[model samples]
Target: MRGNHVIAEAAIRAGCRFYFGYPITPQNEIPEYMSERLSKIEGGVFIQAESEIASIHMVIGASMAGGRVMTSSSGPGISLKQEGISFLSALELPAVIVNMSRGGPGLGNIAPSQSDYFQATRGGGHGDYRTIVLAPNSCQEAGDLTYKSFDLADKYRIPVLILGDGMLGQMMEPVELPPEIPVKRLPPKEWTITGAKGRPSRFIRSLILDPFEEEEHNWKLMRKYEKISKEELLWETFSIEDAKMIVVAFGTAARIAKGAIKRVREEGLKVGLFRPISLWPFPTKILKEISRKVKHLFVFEMNMGQMVEDVKLAVDGGAEIHFYGRPGGIIPTPLEISRIISSYYYQKKLG
Candidate 1:
């Protein structure tokens, strides 16, 4: 299955009933698949909105009505939806957002890129809130993460981001599709804006007019985020035990780094790979533990050193960190990365 289509299909099986998005490269297949597939589902709905901004707001509406909702786009389109994302955060609504990012600053090409790392992890919109960020490197992880994202969003009442790049979005891979979940089996959302007819009067709004009330609301959101950072963390490690050097990466870059590590291992070098599946709530504590054992850490990314910052914070001076990056949409091969890894390992005399 193509990665983008897998996200759409996985979402359907996960009980996502509403999808809102505009056409954008790399991820256009998500909406295209959703539009055709959703039309046939029992309660499914798909809308190709007039703009990305409009689509995100539409997501807010569906989520407000207690539906499993999603929206997808590449870098530029995602940028246009930032304000609504902040709105979703303030409203404390549950929704899934897919970013099959492409090269960018403005109107960057449709080719694969990971330049949105900072944007996705840092709560791109205007707010002091954060959305859970999940980075999936392959089609399988992409599908699996999308299926899981809905649950995470509802569990925390926060938006969940499935971060990917054009390569993952466009490639084909054999993925074991998730089983279709019955929508009726899903739990009810008590906060939905259903009619207040029979019960006591109630309303939902993000406008916390008074400054003191807003401050409390902000702290409440921070408390929720703290809870997430504590409980919701995911990462993968390969050949990490007894390693002299570790390479930290996520998403597609991690896959490449893994291959490079394998190659270096065959040459009798003790190099390992660390992949952070949850970009936010980053693998700080565990990574710090690894740094105590391994004195050298390296970070690789398609973009110019965005995730490296997190790696540094995790190591916190316990390990010496090195970085190699290919910015501006240049995809490096495993051989190229392996050479760099070998060179760095020997230079540090860790052989």
Candidate 2:
């Protein structure tokens, strides 16, 4: 399955019947697929809004009405949707926002890049809130994690981000797809503004006029975020036992690093791989635990050192950190990274 198509189909299986989004590079297939498939499902709604901003606000509206909704875009488009994403967080709405991220700062390129790490993990929107960010490396993970995003969003009543690069979004792979969930069997959202028949009327609002009330709301958000950080952390490790060095990466970069690690290990290298699945609730505790046994950690990214900062903070000077990056949409070859790893291993005398 094509990566973007997989995500769209997975969203459908996860009971995401409402989708509002605009077409954007590298990720246009996501919305395109939604536009086609959603209309076939009973009660499904798909809207190609006038713009990215308009699409995200539409998502907010659908989510407020207690529907499983999603919106997708690339970097530039996502930038336009940030204010709406902030509003979703403020309103405690459940929606999935997909960013098949491409090169950026400002419409950099359609080529594969992980430069949006900062934007995705650091709560790209303006506010005192955070969204759950999931990074999927392959078409299978791209589908699997996207299916799970909706549940996480509704469970926590927060926005969930699916962060994928152009490579992951365009790659073709065979995937074990999940079973489609019947829409009626989906989880109930009691807080939504559904018709208030015979019940006290309730309204949804993000605006808290009182400073004290707003502060309390922000704190409330923080506490929920803290709970997610503890319970929702996800990561993957490769052949880490008795390893002297570990390479830290995520998504497409991590897939490349995994290949590089395998190549080097064939020649008796002690390097392993650590791939974070959830970017926001980073696997800090586990990474820090690995830092105790491993002293050298190599960080590789498609961008100019975004996730590396998270690694540095995770280990906190307890280990030696080396970073390699390819900015401006350049995807490095596995052999090139393997050679770099070998050189660093010998130079640092890590065996």
Candidate 3:
């Protein structure tokens, strides 16, 4: 299946009954597929929203009403959704947002790039809120993680982001759809303003002017994030026990890095790979443990030193940390990565 199609099917199986989004390159297939399939289901609703802002709000509204909702977009569209995302976080609405990143600070080309790292991992919108961001490296993961994103969102009562690049969105691979897991329905919306009941109306506002009240709310949010960091950090390690050097990467960049690691191994270099599946609640403890064993670490990404920062924080300078990447749709090929690793290996030997 194509990656976007897999994600669409997975969303339906995850009980995502409402999908509101605008068409964006590389990911338009998701909304397009939903258009064809969602209406076939009894309760499914698919809307081509006027804009990304409207789309995100629509999802939030649906979520507030005790429905599983989702939206998909690319970089520019994602920027438009940030405001609503912050609103969702403030309200603690459970929703999923998929970003199949293309190039850009603005209207960049429709090609794969990991340039949106800061925007996704860091809060792209205003205020103190964190998004649980998942990075999927392959077409299968693209589907599986999209489903998992919704579960995580519901578990944390926060928005979850499935971060992918155009390459992952466009790629085709075999994917086995997981068995339908029962959707954990939220309690009745007594707190949500479904309608004016006989009792006092409920309000959904993201405003707290009092200093102490705001501090308390912020602290609660922080505690939730800390708990998430402890429980949700996820990663994959390949052949690191005897590794002299470790390659750190995530999403599609990690797939390329894995290929490079295979090539270097063929040439008799003891290189291993570590790929983080969760970008925000990064697998810091595991990376730190691996860092103590490896003498050197190389971080590969499609952007300029975004995940590298996290690697440095994890390793804490225990091992030499190096970086290599290309920005704005320029992909680092397996051979190119191999050359980079080979050069670093020789440089370290001489040093």
Cα-based TM-score, every candidate:
0.99, 0.99, 0.95
Q: List, residue by residue over 5-25, the lDDT tens digit for candidate 3.
A: 999889888888899999989
Please count the clashing residue pairs in each candidate, in the order shown: 0, 0, 0
Name model 3 segments beyond 4 Å from true: 181-192, 196-201
Candidate 2 wrongly placed segments (more than 4 Å): none
Off by more than 4 A, model 1: none
Q: What is the Å distance of residue 172 in model 2 from its true position?
A: 0.4
What clash count does candidate 2 reach?
0
lDDT of 1 by residue, 116-202 (tens): 999999978997989999999999989999999999999999999999999999999999999999999998888888788788866
| Model 3, C-alpha of 291: deviation from truth (Å) | 1.3
Per residue, candidate 2 scores C-alpha lDDT tens digits across 1-351 of 999999999999999999998888899898889988988888989999999999999999999999999999999998999999999999999999999888877879999999999998887788788999999999999989999999999999999999998999899999999999988898787898988898999999998999999999999999999999999999999989967889999999999999999999999999899999999999999999999999999999999999999999999989999999998888999999999999999999988
Q: With candidate 3 superimposed using the best TM-score fit, by how many Å does residue 216's alpha carbon deviate from the native? A: 0.7
Evaluation by lDDT, superior candidate among 1 and 3 = 1
Worst 10 residues of 3 by lDDT: 182-191
Residue 90's lDDT in candidate 3: 88
